[model samples]
Target: RLQRDQELTGVDVVVLDECHERHLDADTTAAFLWDVRQALRPELRLVAASATTDAEGWSRLLGGAPVVEAPGVSYPV
Candidate 1:
């Protein structure tokens, strides 16, 4: 959508799940979203989420965005 210069109408948030996997497509999408947020939509909310992701690194990459953690649930194996 971004490459075509189409506006992200009605889209308030974007969550990149499993960011720790570091796949090329995911990385590229994140990069593009970051660019969009920076250049076009400063109000756009972007979230990079993963249970084992580097929170600090992602936060820094997202221009000092805050890191929010959800409590984990324990389950017997």
Candidate 2:
């Protein structure tokens, strides 16, 4: 999609929200998403957000890529 179509031409930054949704395991999805991103768009910044996942998996996928986490709101038990 990046070559035939300019899907990433004007994209300043790409935030891959809910990237883990694609995988049954959050960590597994992180690795998969990272590989997909690297294969598709290495320059575009990819971000992942989830209730049970964190930037560690993302780092592994991204080879120690930087991660900025925003504390998510939680409901009462």
Candidate 3:
């Protein structure tokens, strides 16, 4: 967890899935992880992934990291 110090050590990447929900805990975790990436683990790969997320906003939050858009598929019910 990002709450613990040095918790992310040895981690190659951290993928926060379903970030579009935007809950309090998720927001805090994102902020802390961003801080960790900035101040401690510069090489730590961080990914905020979601199906219906605000890519631009998250990109800004993650220090202007590039937002990669993947092709989506839709099926009719």
Candidate 4:
């Protein structure tokens, strides 16, 4: 995001690839997610993909927001 000097507020949708990736810097990820939530205009959507509980946890974090989980061709477990 810094490449364009853009803030998350300029975004309308957030797609979290490999939602199972837990090693992403927590602060940075949280900041991005916070902005995604705050920047939305109520009708905005967030898409998280991963066959794991990580996606579900994110939904709960966003207060039961809608989540789209895509089925992976191969199981990570």
Candidate 5:
């Protein structure tokens, strides 16, 4: 949406799921979001949701943003 519209205006947040895979598209999206947040919208909230994402790496990428890890709970099916 950012590239197509040139800007993501009025949006509150963007949540990226399955970021632990670290695919090209995910990385690109993260980079774009980062750039947009830096240059355009400082208030835009970006959340990288994943089971195995490198919190430290992503936090650093996001200008030392805080990384909050949720407690993992599982139940057998």
Candidate 6:
């Protein structure tokens, strides 16, 4: 949707999952979202989620955003 230059309309948040993978498409999407947030929608909320991602690195890349860590979950095998 972003690459196609389509408007996000009523969407207020975007979640980028598996950011630790560092795939090209995901990177591009992240860049686009960052651009949109900076240039178009300053209020648009963006989230990058991964179990093992570099929280500080991503926070720096996202303009010094704060990092939130969640407790891991495990089930009996």
The TM-scores, one per candidate, come to 0.85, 0.54, 0.84, 0.54, 0.81, 0.85
The global Cα lDDT (0 to 1) of model 1 is 0.88
lDDT at residue 16 of model 3 (Cα atoms): 94
Candidate 2: minimum summed lDDT over ten consecutive residues — where? 1-10
Give the per-residue Cα lDDT of candidate 6 at 61. Answer: 87
Q: Write the per-residue lDDT of candidate 4 for residues 1-77, one digit (tens) a residue.
A: 63343354566776666666667574476556666456644544566666665666888866797876555587579
> Candidate 6: where is the Cα deviation over 4 Å?
4-7, 73-77
How should the candidates be ordered by lDDT, best one leading? Answer: 1, 6, 3, 5, 4, 2
lDDT of 1 by residue, 1-77 (tens): 76676347778999999999988899899988988888888999999899998999999999999999998898999
True-structure RMSD, every candidate: 1.7, 4.6, 1.6, 4.1, 1.7, 1.9
TM-score pick, better of 2 and 6: 6
Instruction: Provide the lDDT at 62 for model 2.
Output: 65
Model 3, TM vs. native: 0.84
lDDT for 15 in candidate 4 is 67
Model 6 misses residue 53 by how many Å? Answer: 0.6
- Judging by lDDT against the true structure, name the best candidate: 1
Off by over 4 Å in 3: none
Q: How much is the lDDT of residue 48 in candidate 2?
A: 61
Over the stretch 1-77, how does candidate 5's per-residue lDDT look in tens digits? 77776468778889988878867988888889888888888888888777787889877877887988889788899
Candidate 6: which pairs clash?
A: none
Q: After aligning candidate 3 to the native by TM-score, how far in Å is the CA of 53 from where it should be?
A: 1.0
After best superposition, candidate 2 residue 25: deviation in angstroms? 14
Estimate the overall C-alpha local distance difference test score of candidate 5.
Answer: 0.83
